[model samples]
Target: MYLGVLALTAFVLTVFLLVYLGLFLGRLPFLQLDRTGVVLLGAIALVATEVVPLSGIGEVVHLPTLALLFAFMVISAQLRLGGFYDWVVVWLDRRALAPPVLLGAVIAVAAALSAVFSNDIVCLAMAPVLAQLCRARGYAPLPHLLALACAANLGSALTLIGNPQNMLIGEVLRLDFGDYLRVAALPVLLGLLSTWVIIAGLSRGHWLEASASLLPSALGRAGEVGVPLDRWQTFKGLTVAALLCAAFLWAHWPRDLLALAGAGLLLTSRRLHSRQMLGLVDWQLLVLFVGLFIVNHAMQQTGLPAQAVAVLADEGLDLQEPAPLFAASVLLSNLVSNVPAVMLLLPVAQAPVDGPLLALSSTLAGNLLLISSIANLIVVQAAARQGVVIDWRAHARVGLPVTLVSLVIAAAALLPWRA
Candidate 1:
């Protein structure tokens, strides 16, 4: 029996390492698989080898997190298809504001919207529009695009429903919605301001450079692909979104259930096809979550995490404490990406302060690199589609400092509340 357990442990560790390696590298080294593919492959291997029973798959997956994520994706899809995001971009672009003011506006809008919606979705919807807007206005799009990504990440840290990992953190910890926001609001606000300052300062003289040559082709392509603003649909999406936020704050209703209901309401539409809304859902990300949950649960069954925690405790690095937890959150978040890192750390988050600390640390750490967050990648890819190349160096120049400053600010703001 001991030997059998040892073999299972070894198999689980091997699969875990290989899966995380793919996550860290964004692909399997030479294989055509992305992170989602690699994770799915590892999970299939586990099930096929009987390391995790097929029937136990349902036991391992966190249904609430998955349900909440799907609900919010549907909500975001509704807003995206309704052209709400495009309206915001066009509204901002027509303002004729000066460069710094315009940058601030972009940051502010992105931050606010991201606080309510999925940061990744917010970036996905806004990046291309912002890029084309910059091209048309003869301004550099890199700064605005980076600001959108950074601000979205920072602001999403403010609320429970803002991003997937935050949702997971909230659900696992059973954190009070209003209380978490009270703790997170200040730091998130300061972080957004810091993002604006850094990006604005970095793009000082080059903000207004003409991209006339790049504009026509990009603008034409953008128009072809862009969703036009539908006033009625936009109003409906916004109304539902507002009510959902209210429900999260005021009602004692299960958040996942309420969000699911909201999604259902949006789906029962005459003009917008359900297929169109469903098509916008990030099915790949949902699958990735399922795969990671199964793998992590199997690893937990091996008792390795508990032993490792014991070792760390013996060394005086108690993970239950806020400081070490904060440090670990940042390191692991950047190492394996935020969602999986949060899943790994969820078991050790015991203190009252640990929930907010985990949420803030993991979310803020996403600003450390372009590869660190899906929001950043979305922005980068969206800009690339419009003939603007924002490479790693370009992103890091802003990301590193923004991450450091935001982390410091969050730490300072949360220090008084630390247990």
Candidate 2:
């Protein structure tokens, strides 16, 4: 009996470490596995070892979070398919706004959309188009792309539907939508403003590439951008999104169920095929959610995380407290990305105020470093295709300040809630 318990504990610990190692490194060494693959393998190993039985996965994984994530993905897919994201960028390019004003416009649109759509999807659909637009307008894609990434991450904190981790926090904590918006509004607004200031300051005198304008090669990647703006389709997507947001604020229904109903309505459209809409759903991320759910549950069941929290509390670093939770969230978020960090720290977030703190800190802190948020990576990758390179040093120069200020604003705003 003793040997069996010891072996099981060791197995769980080893698996947990392996999974996080892959997460932190963004890929496993020998297996060459990506983030999703690593977690899926870890969960499969645990179940194969009979640590977390397959049948009990329903209890371990939170279905509502997955459902909510999928539903929102569908909603965003609708907009992407309708070319709303492309149209926004094309509209901005056609405006012929000043360089500073252009940057601000991108920030505003990205942040506003991210507040409602999933941030990753927002970036995925917009970055390619925005990159081409910047190049065509005789501007380097760096400042504008950075604005999009930073603004999306910053704005995703405004509401639960904005990002995956926020949705998870909301579903797990059962937080009211209106209430969370009230908590996050001030900080998110301040963060978006800071993002614009930092980018605009850093990009002064480099806004327009005078000699590069009108290069035919700039639009070479237009094929990768989202579809053209179908006004009717875009209208349909907007209406559904508005209704979903209203329902989230006032309706008594479960958020996941409400979002799914909205998704169903969009999917049933005669103009858009169900497969086309479903194809954009990001099945990998949904599977990653499932895998992380099981692995984190297995970790929780091992009782080690609980014991560690107890020890930390005795050591005067109680995670339940606002300051420590806020700091830890920022650190963990930058370390292994926000979703995994949120999953690791979620157990201690029992207080009503913890939801807003965790969501804001985790999502906002990603702006500190390059590739810390998937939005950052998406923007960077999209720009690289457009002949622009934004290295880590460049990102840190601007992102570091924005992250520090945002976290400070968030802490000041949220800590008062606990009192």
Candidate 3:
């Protein structure tokens, strides 16, 4: 039994290492593995090694994560169709505020939108809009691009539905939406403030006193504002989304059922192409969640998690308790990117601490590395298309310090909830 556990541990570790390498290195000699592909490959490795049986895999797969993820994707899908995200960015850009005030407004708006939608989508939709707006207004796009990325991450902490992992943590932990909000609201508030200050400081040194032509050379440069909204399709998506959110908050509906129903409603569209809705589904993210569930589930069944918990306890670090878990969460979140790191630690985290700590650490840690969060990458990629350069050095200038400040703020806020 011990030998089996050890071998399983080795297998899981090896799979994780390979996945990390693949993400960092990108395409291991034509294997061409991105993050999701790496996770799927890891699952295959576990199964092929005979270390995790099929039944054992079932025990570890987390349904709550998938359900909540699906729900938010549906909601975000609908919002995108509604032209909501695009409209919000335009409103911010058109405001005739001072540069500092404009910066604050941008961060505030980005944060609020990200609270209810996928921050990744929010950034993808808004970054180009923001870049062009800055160029048009004679301001550097870098500051706004950084603000969009950072604020999107910070804002995602506002609600249980903010990011994919928060939804998972909230659903699996059976946290009340209201209750989760009450708990997380403080840190999110503090985090956003810190983001603004940090961003402002970073911007002062970089903001150039020159205006660039706002005239979009290409239609794509005009951002989502210039795109024609399919009003009927937008209405269909929003109605389904609104009803689902109402069900989640008021009826306490089983999230999966509500989301699946919502997604079904959208599928019934007569005007919109089914392919377009399907394209917006974020299938890769879903696959990443499923793959991590299988791999982590296998690890738990092998008794490795139990042994590790015992060993940590012996070292005076019980993850079942809050503080150590919070510390562990921050460390691992930066190391492996929050979502997969959370999956590895989830089995050991018990209750309140698990929900809040996982949410806090994972979300805050995204500010640490350029590759730490998909939201960051989305913003970076979107900005790149607009000729706005934000390399690792530029990102780390803001990301590293913002991560530290946010984590510290979260630690203080979390002390009351730790067991």
Best candidate (score: TM-score): 2
Evaluation by TM-score, superior candidate among 1 and 2 = 2
Candidates in descending TM-score order: 2, 1, 3
lDDT of 2 by residue, 299-321 (tens): 89889999999999999999999
Task: Give lDDT tens digits, candidate 1, residues 1-419.
Answer: 99988888999999999999998888997899999999999999999998889998988888888899999898889889888898788888767667688789998999899988999999999998888788777777888888899999998999998899999999878998999999999999988998988998898878765634323323333454388888888888889989989988999988988989998999999999999999999999999999999888888888999999999999999898788889999999998899989999999998888899999999999999888999999999999999999999999999999999999999998798764
TM-scores, all candidates, are: 0.95, 0.96, 0.89
Candidate 3 per-residue lDDT over residues 1-419, each given as its tens digit: 98976766777777766776665554455776777888888888877776667666656667766866876676677667766666666666556556678788988888988887789988987887777677666677787788788889989987778888788777777777777777788988888898889888878855653544333222233433544455666667667766766777788677777777777777676665667666787988888887878767765665767898899999999888887888888787777777877777777767665788788888888888888888888888888888888999999998888889988888898887755
lDDT of each: 0.89, 0.89, 0.77
What TM value does model 2 have?
0.96
Comparing 1 and 3 on lDDT, the stronger one: 1
Give the distance in Å from residue 393's predicted Cα in candidate 1 to where it truly belongs.
Answer: 1.4
